[model samples]
Target: MNAVKTGSHAASTLEKTPVGDLVDGKGHSSGAEWLTRYSTSLMGVFGTPQRVLVRGAGCLVWDADGKEYLDLLGGIAVNALGHAHPFVTSVISSQLATLGHVSNFFTSPTQIALAEKLLALTHAPPGSKVFFANSGTEAVEAAFKLARRNGASPDGTTGKRTKIIALEGAFHGRTMGALALTAKEAYRAPFEPLPGGVVHIPFGDVAALEAAIDETVAAVFLEPIQGEAGVRPLPPGYLKAAREATTKAGALLILDEVQTGIGRTGKWLATEDAGIVPDAITLAKGLGGGFPIGALLTFGEQTSSLLAAGQHGTTFGGNPVATAAALATLHAIESQRVLENVAVVGDYLRTGLAAVDGVTEVRGEGLLIGFDLDAEVAPAVVTAGLDAGFIVNSPGPRTIRLAPPLVLTKDQTGTFLAALPAILRTAKDAQ
Candidate 1:
C-alpha cells in the first residue's frame, strides 16, 4: 500500500477529485487529501490536521490511509468508553429513532433520569439540582451564571458579590463567560473586555485563596486535576481548604470537573476523593462518553434555586438522544466495573511511564495521565508517537498527556509501554 501523500501535490489532487469521491470507508481518499481539503474549507484555529481519522473502536482508531493507532489521548478525555462504544451508540440510535429532540418547553424521562442519577452519584442533598448543557464550556457558562446569581448581598440584594476566583493555570473554556474565568492571557487577550470581576490566583496556594476570597467574591472555581495544564493535580488538602475559605467568606465553591469527572479519576467526581461537596460542579468531557453532554450540579436548595426558570436554557441541552447517551454511558461504567479497571490500569500506566528512560516525572490519577520528559521535545514526541502507530498529546513543551479510554486494558497499556522508549529516542533525535 502507498504511504499517505502530502504538500501541494496532494492538495491539487484533492481539488481535482470529485466531491462525491470522498465518501467514508471507500479508501478512495488519503489522509493527506482529506487534510488538504480540510485546510482550505475549515477554520485555522486548530491548525493543520495530524491525520484524518476514518473510524474507531474501543481504544483504537484508523486513519483514512488504513493506518491503525492506539488512541492514548481518547479525544482529550472525551471518549470515556472509547470511540463508537456499542452500548452508547445503541442507546443514542434507539433514542433518536424513538424521539430525537424536544424543546425546553417539555422534558423527557431520560433527561430527568440522568439528572437524578448525577445527583445521586454525587451524593447531593435533597433539593439539589442538575442543569444540562451540550458541552463543557456551556456547562461552565451556566456555572458562571449560577455564581453570579448567588452573588447577592447577605440580605439577598443583588450586585454585592461580583468577583469570581479561578486558578492561574485554569482552562475553563473558550466561550465568552467561560473564557473570562479562564486564566490564560493569550486566550483572554484576544477577546478583551470580557465579563469582568473574574480573578486568577496562584494554583494550589491555600494562603492565596484565603486572602483572595472575601464577601465580594461570588465563587471560587477549581479543577481537581488541570487537564489542559498538563494534567496537574491540585496540592493535597487544597480542595478542603478552598471549601472552608469559600464557606467562611459566603462564596460558592465551584469545581470544574470537565476532564476529571465521570470516572476519569477512578471516581464519579475527583472532588469526591477530597471528601468535599462543592456548592456546584461543572461536568463534561466524559459525561456522555463522546456524545457531547455537559452538566452543572448544585449541592443544595439555595444554590439550586439561584437560577430560576427562564434565567438560563439551551435548545438541545437535554434532548432525548443526548440524555439516552449519557444514561447508557453511566450504565456501562457501572455494569462493566470500569471504575475498578481505571484504578488498576491507571496505576499500571503511571508505574510503567515512570520507568521509561526519558521520563522525568508522572502526574495524574486514573486514566488521565501526564508525564514530563527529561528534554523539551513533547511536540516531537507526539509526532513520533503518531508515526509509531500510537496517538498521544503534548499539552506543553515538556509534557506528554495520556487520557486514554476508561476501558483501556492492561495489555494495551503494556503495548504502549513497550514502545515508549524508542518513541522517546526518536523524538529526541528529531528535536
Candidate 2:
C-alpha cells in the first residue's frame, strides 16, 4: 500500500505507523494507516476515511489505535440509545436464539408487536397498516409504490395519476425511485434516466405547494425536518398546509421521517405535533438502534388498501432480530426517560453552541441538532473536532449537523462545547 505522506510530521508518521498491529519495533499505526486496506476492500463512494473506528459504547467510540471520540453523530442518527447499549444487545441475542428469521411468510410475536407499537405511536386513524423493509430507502420505495398504486385508475387504464411532488433540498433516499424525489443535482446527475413522475418545489412555500397540488399528483413527499439539508425544519403550519392541499387535491401526503422519527425531535413522531394525519409515513434509522430496519405506515382505509399482499414484499423486512432490536430501543427510550434528556440537554447544547465563535446559527429539536458555521470550514471543523476527541458531521460546506445519541447528557455535551473553540480555530487556520 502507498503511504501518501505530507509535511514534516508525514515523514515520521509514515515510517513509524504500524502496518496492522505493529511497525518495525516502534509505535502502532491504526488511524489513517488502515485506510489503504479499506480502499482495497471497500467502495470509494463515500470518499476518504475520517478515522478507523473500531468499537463504541454509549456516546463514545474508540479507533483502531485506541483513540477515543465522543460520537455526536450517532451513526448519522441511527443509534437511538447510543452504541452497544446492553438492553439492545440482550434483546437481539434472546430473539436470535429463539426465532431469528421466519421471513414475511410467517410473522413472529416480536415483529407483530413492534408494528402495532409503531402504529400506536403515530396515532393513525381507525385503520392503519405497516409494511416493513430493511432500510430507509426500502421504506421510501414501498411508500412510493403505494402512492403509485393508490393513484392508479381502478381499471388500470391510461391517464393514471403517477406524478409525485417533493420539496427542494429534500433527501428521500438513494434508490432510483427515491433519488427521483431528491433535488440535489450532484447526487442525481450520474444516476439519470431515473424513475420519472417526480417534480420539486420550494420548501415552506404554502402558495407554491397549493399551486402544485392537483388530482394529477399521486403523493406529496416531505420531511417534518430536513435532516440532510442541515436539519432544517418545515416552516410553521407548512405541514398543515400540505395536508390540506393534498387532501383537497386527492393526493397522498407521505412524510419521510427516516431521520426525524423515533423521538429524535423530542416526540414519538414529528408529524404528531402538526396535528395532521398524513396518508403515509416512512421510517428507519433510529427505529432499529443501528440495526437496519424500515417501515412504511399507511393511515385510514384509502391509504391502507393501496398495496395488496403480492403487490409488495420483503425477504428480511421485519426479521425477528431486527424487530427485537427495535422493540428494545423503544423500551429503553421510554423506560430510561431518554427523550426528556434529549429535550433538556439538546436545548442546553444548542444554546451553548450558538454562543461559540464560529457558529452563526443553531437549529433542531431534541437530540438532533444542526448549526451554520460562520465560514465554509465545516469539513475542516469536523476534522479538528475528531482530533480533539469529538465526532461530528458537515453535510454542506458551511453546515454542521449533530444527531447524537438520545442518551447524551449535558456533561458529555459540555466536553464538545469546551473543545469546539479550539477546533474552530484550527479549522480556520487550515482554511
Candidate 3:
C-alpha cells in the first residue's frame, strides 16, 4: 500500500508536464524538465520518454516525485548487479580520482585486467585479445570488422567470403555494421543501403541456417538468446549445427552476447549453455554494471592482426573509471554469487508467470524472462503493472518481458506476482 501510494506521486508529476514544454523551456530543475530538454536535443530514435527516474538503489528506482518502483526491466538487461552497488561506485570513484581516461596508445591496469578476466572466463586460448569500445553497437561493429579481416578467401582479398549470416528477429545494434546484421525492418528501413553483404535466416531453424551459410559466407552471427525478440531461446542443437556448418565452410562464428553475458543468463556467457566457442564474442550491456563500456574478444587463429594501430579507436572506450566499474562488477558477481541468485530468482519469477492467466508461454533463462499473452493485450498489461507500481515492458504486441535486476529478492517477486492477477484483470477491463 505504501508503494502504491508513493507510485501515484511519481506518475502525477510525469503526467502534469507536457514533454514538449520541458524540452523547449528553460530554468526548470525537475527530472521532468530534464527529460523535456533531453527530448528536444536528443534524437527521436527511442520514441517518447517514460517516467524520469531520479535515483536508484538495489533493484528499486524512484521517479522524479520520489515514488519507488521495482525495476523489472533492469535498464534492458544491463544492470547485472543492480544499480548503485557500493563496489561499483567505489571503484569508479577511486579510479576517476586517480586517472580518469587515457588514449588507446597508452594502457591502464583496469582495462588490461578487465580484458584479461573476460578472456579467461570465456576460456579463450592463450594470446586471445580484446578491443574495447564505447557501447554495444560499437562492439558489434568491431566484431563485424574483425570477422571480415580474418575471412579473406584464397584470392587474398575479401571477394567470395563477403556475406554475414544473421538471424531473423535478431537485434545486434543500430550502428551501420551492426544494423546490417539486425533483422528489424522498422529499425532499418529508414537507413537503407546499410553496410551490405548480410543475409537473414529464421532463428532456431538449423536447416535454414545450413541453407543460407556456405563458402561465400564470412561468418555466422547470432545471439544465443534473442533478447529483443521476446527472449527466445535457441533450440537444442541449433548452435552446435551452426558451429559445425560454419567450420565446414571456413566461416567464423560470432556470438553477440551484449544482452545475455556477464551473468544475466545464469551463466557467464549464454554460448556456454550451447557448448559452442565462437570465434569472436561481442559484449556490453551488463558488463559495466551501469557504466558505459563494450568489448570484443577474439581467440586462437581467428584473432586476426586486423585494425592497424590507427584503424579504429574511441576516446572514452576504455576510460579508467568505467573499466574500474566493470572490474568491480565482475568481482562482485563472482564473490557475491550473483549468478546463483539470478538462477534462483529467475526460476521463481518464471514459475509464477506460468501460473498467471492469459499467459500462453514462458521462455528465457536467468533473470531475463518473457511470457506471451494469449491475445494482443501486452500493452494493457504493462500499463496495469505500471499503475500497480511495478515497472515492466511489452517487447512485442503479445509478449511481456521481465529483465529484473539480479538483486531483486524473492519477497519483491512475490509482491509483483500477488498483484499480477488483478493487474491482468485490470488490463482486460481496459481492453
After TM-score superposition, what is the CA distance of residue 35 in candidate 2 from its true location, in Å?
1.7
Q: What lDDT is obtained when candidate 1 is compared to the true structure?
A: 0.92
Best by TM-score: 1
Worst 10 residues of 2 by lDDT: 18-27
lDDT per residue as tens, model 2, 361-423: 998888888899889999999989988999999999999999999999899999889889999
Which lDDT value does model 3 have at 68? 86
lDDT of each: 0.92, 0.89, 0.86
Q: What digit string (tens of lDDT, one per residue) describes model 1 on residues 326-408?
A: 99999999999999999999999999999989899999999999999989999999999999999999999999999999999
Each prediction's RMSD to truth: 7.1, 8.1, 7.8
Off by over 4 Å in 3: 1-41, 153-157
**Top-scoring candidate (lDDT):** 1
Model 1 alpha-carbon drift over 4 Å, by segment: 1-27, 153-157
